[model samples]
Target: MDNNSCGCNVCSTREDLPWEGRGTDLPIAGCRFTLYPMTDRYVDIILGSLEKTDTSYVWSETDALSTVYRGKLPYVADAVKALFVNAYRSGVHMALEGQFSKGCPGDIAGDSLLEKDGEAPNAKSAEGIHFPVKCKLALYPMGVGNYIDDIAKVWYMAQDRGLEPTTIHYATRISGDVHDVFDYLRDVCALMDESAVSHYILHFTVNCNSPTKE
Candidate 1:
């Protein structure tokens, strides 16, 4: 068979096909983020909190820097939100930075491919691609005292409206439907101004594109 003939719906005889046209479905998508506990007490609380059972995600912690969670988009978001909420309830200052992508980006998690007919394709296979939604985010608890509580108020408000966030040096990367990403951002912004903190900070970068292009 010719290089252009893969005998699959994904393959066409056009070498000039744009990356987006190559495939629309991806098998695995995820995000990477770093959690920052502003104080020693907050650090301990955050680390200890992660020690609990969380079957919804495949997560890893690196001593005192960050944690990487890989799994379905919804599960990842839920896990991050729960962590933030629980940490805030402890009354400690904290922040989270992250990035989310639908298709494999550097295979940071190492599970970017799926087996197909006893072999894995060298490139992204449409059979396993998830919907393409990419976003970057950051969450910070402001003020010196009672900041966690202040941030918590905004956190829940964002949740009430719906937002999920993550970081730089460390980032929480997530990929999914375009609408879902937008909804997450909208909620984050809504809480930025309502928090009790003197100045709550939230940062975001969003992209909707194919894995190949990302």
Candidate 2:
């Protein structure tokens, strides 16, 4: 055990104890998500999306309520983005709610994914897919002081990316192309200060192809 390593869950959750490191070290990441496509063909949409998206670099498990995908950060993001985009339809409304987490103590169930190599298999196939989506994300930078400032930084990044963010009570809502929205969310997870905030979580909800006016 090094100076940065800790054994207690409380310390890890409170971020009072640091782990080996999250940067470049490739700490495990995961997201559990549920997708709702508001159309009679929702069953087809869900099944088709799952079949179309590649999960070669990620480990995934699905059940009645939601699906959990875990792996290296980038691969996880790739899988997530591909899944949502593959399921999108021009006329039907679709929504996905997900909880993303990284560096949780004892979260090694998907450690095997680290052994897999190469880029996310879905990355190449998902290219050039574009559609509009409305998204809001609540980022929790665990144990970091001035956390609100960090959140504001993400908001600013969204604006810079032309996402058109709107401040809501608990989360910041942004609207833009699905590709950009997913990329921004992925960038947030990858670009944060890994040493300062060891464990961070994001509650994200995104919807697309909606009939309702906004």
Candidate 3:
């Protein structure tokens, strides 16, 4: 195989491709996120965070909208957490909007990433960094017949964890330490089963140091 070749469902030259033999059961994950820093120094904050965070385990790209990370789930999650924490500035309201996806039928470009493995390198260093955050998230478990029931179960799960989420239009709001929010999200993502969902996406926004008077 050439270094540039992609052995995915759409490009594989092999007769017995995995997807054809069984199915497209890759564990590839991705995250696209944009950070909004509430200050004139926003550019510095965004760039600085990118510099400090370690994204070596993942394939990453940045454009006008947001930074996209594609790789194993742990690397994708840890990269997001480390970047957000690195960008934290006290008294400056910062917002990060992100979309995390797994098992998407169209996501074949990063299939090679599955061969790469190990713990997220930056996760250890970013541990124990605490900050308050308010977040809103919408979870979609695709192709499930009773999606509302699954969604409701997540709501109840959050309540059980003592992270009572407030119902808002199009999303649910949860307030807590940054670590807790991320942990909750990890669990939420884990709730999806391969046999049930064709694809799953979690759209969320985390805000810290907001100046909102409410």
Best by lDDT: 2
Candidate 3: tens digits of C-alpha lDDT, residues 1-214: 2222233445455555444343345677888899999899999999999999998888899998889988877778888989999999888899999988876654565433656676778878888689999999999886556789878978987888878799999999998988888878877777765335557799999999887889
TM-scores of the models, in the order given: 0.40, 0.85, 0.84
Q: Give the better candidate number (2 or 3) by lDDT.
A: 2
Off by over 4 Å in 2: 1-26, 109-112, 193-195
Give the Cα error of residue 197 in candidate 3, in Å: 2.0
The pairs that clash in candidate 3 are none
Q: Which of 2 and 3 is ahead in TM-score?
A: 2
Residue by residue across 1-214, what tens digits does model 2's lDDT show? 2223333455545654343342334567889999999989999999999989998888889899999888888898899999998998887899999988875543544343777778678888888888889998999876566778878888898999999998999889999888899999998887664435576788999998777875
RMSD of each: 18.0, 4.5, 6.6
Residue 79 C-alpha lDDT in model 2: 94
